[model samples]
Target: MQQAPRPRFGIMTAPMQVGYHDVLRVWREADAIREIEHAWLFDHLMPIGGDPGGPAYEGWTMLSALAAQTQRLRVGLLVTSNRFRPPAMLAKIAATVDVVSGGRLDFGIGAGSRPSHPLARREYEAHGLPFHDAAHAVGSLAEACTVIRRLWTETEPFDFDGKYVQLTGAFCNPKPVQRPYPPILIGGRSASVLRVAAEHADVWNIPGGDLDDVVSRSALLDRYCAEIGRDPASITRSIHLPVSYDQPGVTRDAIAEAIDAGFQHLVLGLAAPYPAGVARWVTDEFIAPSTWN
Candidate 1:
């Protein structure tokens, strides 16, 4: 069999003010698209870091803008919460975005966590929903996967019955541009999350943690995949690395170590001070170097 393509490198945009739209435009123009295989944004109502009053853009809307502006780069949320909307609706929205992006979409999913916005929390409370524990959250995620899969693959309307979500005759029109739906990426580091990724996800995106944590968790994920009778190679491993390289030549070593340990993608977080400056550093130091090659 032919060897699989080398894992691609990509960047995740920090949530910022709409005025920073021009920053994205500039990055794309500066050959960032050629350097990065994928460009991701977070799905959040407000900044997850720094000043709470800082401006942040809506993820899906930003993705839509990216789809319209870029031709070569894949675009999507780094991980969208399953609790934000019903699965059927989210699936349709994903399909629409995929079509708009000419089929370059990575559907990243995650369980809901503590809301960063008061309005979001209020909405959740108003719906009479309980704040989910990890187990409940994973179960809800499984249900979401079921609904999304059924909407994309089943010809007839389907019903989903789950503890957290229930759908009667949910249907999606104009099936996704990618056959059998776009790639599903699950984001987390817990054992339950690893099991879910082994069972459902095409990609596994783990957050940046201690180096030992990443290695041990990645090994656990491989074990889970084997136990589930799935090839470990089928699941792509990716990581989100923080952007805090105050010194030269550190980021490259980190990337090398991660790649050696079977990580295929690296999403650099630009949430620190001087995001635009960080963007330039990533493009010049990481992308322009031989790390990806």
Candidate 2:
């Protein structure tokens, strides 16, 4: 019997670094949206592995921009960190973005990690919070998810009391276009993260991990889902692959490997050095193929 067609193929926009603006332009011009299922950008306050003074675009703002510029590609934060913004506000912003894109928004989030910039520390310090503790981070992440779900699904003002956040009579207008809400994609490799994905996330993104890693982690996720009485198949499994277009058609092999490992989605992370080149390759090599059929 023929298997159901999998909704595969996604690309992750490198966060604003030294050359991201140029890359963004290339991607926009290439019109890669015609081929890819989704376009994602990382949510971070500062650039990773770059000069501290280098550029870094806000994830949500970039997503909104992509929503306006691209016609067919679904755009979202690869995963925004929950510690950076209140869940209620995040839900409103996601709803607004969803409405703007005519329902092409995928809401992905995670617990915030340490930033490189000293000023970036203000995000946690200003909140009178501590950094570098995984347990606290997971707790914040769980609470944030609860608040976001409540804000999206609850019609009346909702109240949430949690360890990290407390909300009273929180209401957001213009619910997301996706039935109950936009699909939620959560990221992290920890046990807490897996449990959260099983409980709430519609999709779980494994960043830069191998097939064996995914298989092991997936088992844990499935166990958590079973414990919660939720079907593991209900959650889409995705992986972030470091990809380079320099070798023509390199992604095809990677995609095949990912699919073999039961990954339903691929988040391709373009290689550096002329970042725009990756977008061009995707347009000419992937998008032009009429693969979706």
Candidate 3:
């Protein structure tokens, strides 16, 4: 049997549920947890499926604040939308945050807004920005990802040739504090998005999927990695999903299944408001007996 990878926990919380004060408290609590390696927040202008008009803090802005406040945890968005910023600029933002955190930052990215989701369409309408089709958005994401990677590592500036964005003498500086650069995570389900992950991600997040589903998708990613002539093991496997932590056995089983499938980073969508001290609750009920620690 293969030795299981070391596990790292992350709380991928939707912080807008409560006020900003509670949001800060939740992060502090998460930071205090043992083995809690990352602190992630949803990168959305508003909630997707739920209330579209609810209060939501912008992802990158919240990240800058979190970086200064937390000492040990790596701060990042669960996945930032490519449409939000040009690739080079996004890289700069990430690098700056990494510096603020003293090298504690994980850069998670994804193709832009969803076309099918009603709220997404509404957001574009309200904000006066064009909501391009999914194909266009993914293409843009790929291009931006390329620019970000090149900017982070290169000392000299270079031109960016892309359909959506063009950069002459592109450069992002104070290169991320993490050597070689911060871990880049690409998250999504579509093939185009997966291909982008293969091309430029250090970590690929498999969000909202079942165990069997995760296996086949990971196999697909392996195929993508192979197609690119890149080793499949180069990318770290990660996931975040809603689970009924109320049923301790079920929660433990689900986590075990994910670990067996080679997911080293586990970010749970534990219901916000963290209901009765989530950290202590899980540490006692699941984390201890689950063999992750």
TM-score per prediction, in order, is 0.87, 0.87, 0.93
lDDT of 3 by residue, 1-293 (tens): 97666777777777665566666777787788866678788777766755566777888888889778888888888888887776788899889999999998889999866777776567656766677788889989888877887888999989977898899998887898888888899988778888988988999997755678888888899999999899999988998866576677877777878887888888877666667577667666655665634
Please tell me which model should have the higher lDDT, number 2 or number 3: 3
Regions more than 4 Å wrong, model 2:
2-4, 18-23, 27-33, 114-132, 247-251, 272-277, 283-293
lDDT of 2: 0.76
How do these models rank on lDDT, best leading?
Answer: 3, 1, 2
lDDT, residue 137, candidate 2 = 77
For model 2, how does the per-residue alpha-carbon lDDT over 1-293 read when each residue is reduced to its tens digit? 97845646777766656465665675575455455678888876665655656777778887787687777777888789887777889989999899888898989998767455565575466556567567777888888888888887888997777888888889888888887888999987888889888988999988755678778998899999999999998998888877666664666666666776778777777644544466657655653442443
Error of 2 at 140 (Å): 1.9
Sequence-dependent TM-score of model 3: 0.93
- Total backbone collisions for each predicted model: 0, 0, 0
User: Model 1: runs farther than 4 Å from truth?
Assistant: 1-5, 17-20, 30-32, 114-130, 272-281, 291-293
What is the clash count of model 3? 0
Among all candidates shown, the one with the greatest TM-score: 3
In angstroms, the error of model 2 at 35 is 2.1
